[model samples]
Target: MNAESRDRLRVTVARSFDHVVMAMTLRGVTYLGEQRAPYNEEYDGNDLVAASHLIAWRGSEPVGVLRLRWFADFAKVERAAVLPTFRRHGVMRALMQEALRYSARRGYRQVLGHAQLNRVAYWRSHGFRVRPGRPSFMFSDYEYVEIEHPLERPANAITMDSDPLAIIRPDGDWDRPGPFDRSLRRAPRKQRRPEELA
Candidate 1:
């Protein structure tokens, strides 16, 4: 964005009906229309009722959008679509930072995204890491990598493998505990006292 447009950038949670439409409109244009992303694959059923959207606006015109869906152990951020004109202007960054804070405050342990393979560097720049052994997604023109952002890891949190799998799971969503949380429950090895051993 240019300096003037940068000053006008604003991001917010979709509060009203119109705001929701704006989010969808931006998504439709970028994902469905511009990239020609498969309509069926693009329109996952989680939108609207089960997800909340964040929209980046420049003086009332929506320019970027992303959706957040709650999972058992993390928040899944998906379908991030930004206007071609706004691609390098930090709009997505502003929206994602706010979403991360919001998810962390709501007691989520982490956030995950199915990021396009080519944009791996961009996502990494935002503190997202590709887990070891993660699956790669193949679409018409893009492959995806699962990226993660751990929120408030305790000192005792289990150390992830040098490479982890694509794990922010979708099966047991919202309320149900899922298989992906197994590693998180691993207890740190107990240290033995020298006196006891003797």
Candidate 2:
């Protein structure tokens, strides 16, 4: 790794416009330009959310980006991409480590990812394993091998509220309510009565 990559590797949960722009540029180059995935699939509305974007920067330029979507039991780690020039320079590894740390802090027990078919070994090296009985997910042109990484952390960890990138802040005051578990769940909106509709 170069001195800049090793010494100045900075990872942040991106919410600022400037950082998001840099992240989108890098991801566009890798996922859209090189991989030739459809733009809709690559962008996939993840960047629009505040907390889903994780960017790794060297100085002011973003070199890598990753997205994490939380579910009831585990977090989905996806949309990882690194600029061509920065690949193999430790940008991806730095971003992955940071993502894992953030997940642990959020009290997530596991992190899951769909690693590209060719990049199975890379994900495996980071402690992601193929979940037993689950098959690889196919995405039209390419296949994504499923992988999961368990995070060991205290159940009381409540760091998500303090994270500015989080889309949903914890309910009530963090200091007073004490630690709690939460997952993103949406209930169906109530519709007008049948008579009103008629």
Candidate 3:
């Protein structure tokens, strides 16, 4: 990947069902097609709940994806995959950086991921360290090790003190007013009288 190609990469939160499917398609290509992971195991039920998906696009084509599952104290990064053609173009790095950035903005203290044993070095290269005292485990027929990255809370991190509108903004888009915020521009609806209803 040349510098110009790298400049063309854009990572964003998957904001709609279509965007979510695009992310999943990238994962399916890499995990199910390349690695032959079983359908059920790859598309576990957690995707639609307490999770956010990030999709990386090379210009107009979706090239990579990562999923973040929120927990009380931390966010877990999972199902990271990049198309084979885009493997050397730093798409995974972009996804991981965006995931960490989003997590920090949400005021999470740590981000966790399970790295396949062979890919431990790859995760370590991105500032994640193998969690000490955690034993190796196997899942989906592969050896895995727990890894975590510590995040410093940003000065503008979201909290109870944030504006209610900002708190309700879409994931990874806290800085902008959402559709619900825009709706506030309209006059409040008036209620009908009891006789009018009858």
* Top-scoring candidate (lDDT): 3
Give the per-residue lDDT of model 1 (tens digit) for 84-132: 9878889889888877876775567899988888889989998899977
- Per-prediction TM-score, please? 0.70, 0.73, 0.89
> Could you tell me how far off, in angstroms, the CA of residue 6 lies in candidate 1 after the best superposition?
8.6
lDDT of 3: 0.92
- Clash totals for all candidate models: 5, 0, 0
lDDT accuracy of residue 25 in candidate 1: 84
lDDT of 1: 0.77
Q: What is the C-alpha lDDT of each candidate?
A: 0.77, 0.76, 0.92
Error of 1 at 101 (Å): 1.0
Off by over 4 Å in 2: 1-7, 49-51, 159-198
- State model 2's lDDT: 0.76
Pairs in steric clash, model 1: 131-164, 132-163, 132-164, 132-165, 134-166
Per-residue lDDT of model 3, residues 1-198, tens digit only: 666875699899999999999988888888899999999999999999999999998877888999999999999999988888888879999999999999999999999999999999989999999999999999899899999999999999999998888888886798888988999999989999999999
In terms of TM-score, which candidate is stronger, 2 or 3?
3
Rank the models by TM-score, top first: 3, 2, 1
Regions of model 1 farther than 4 Å from truth: 1-6, 153-198
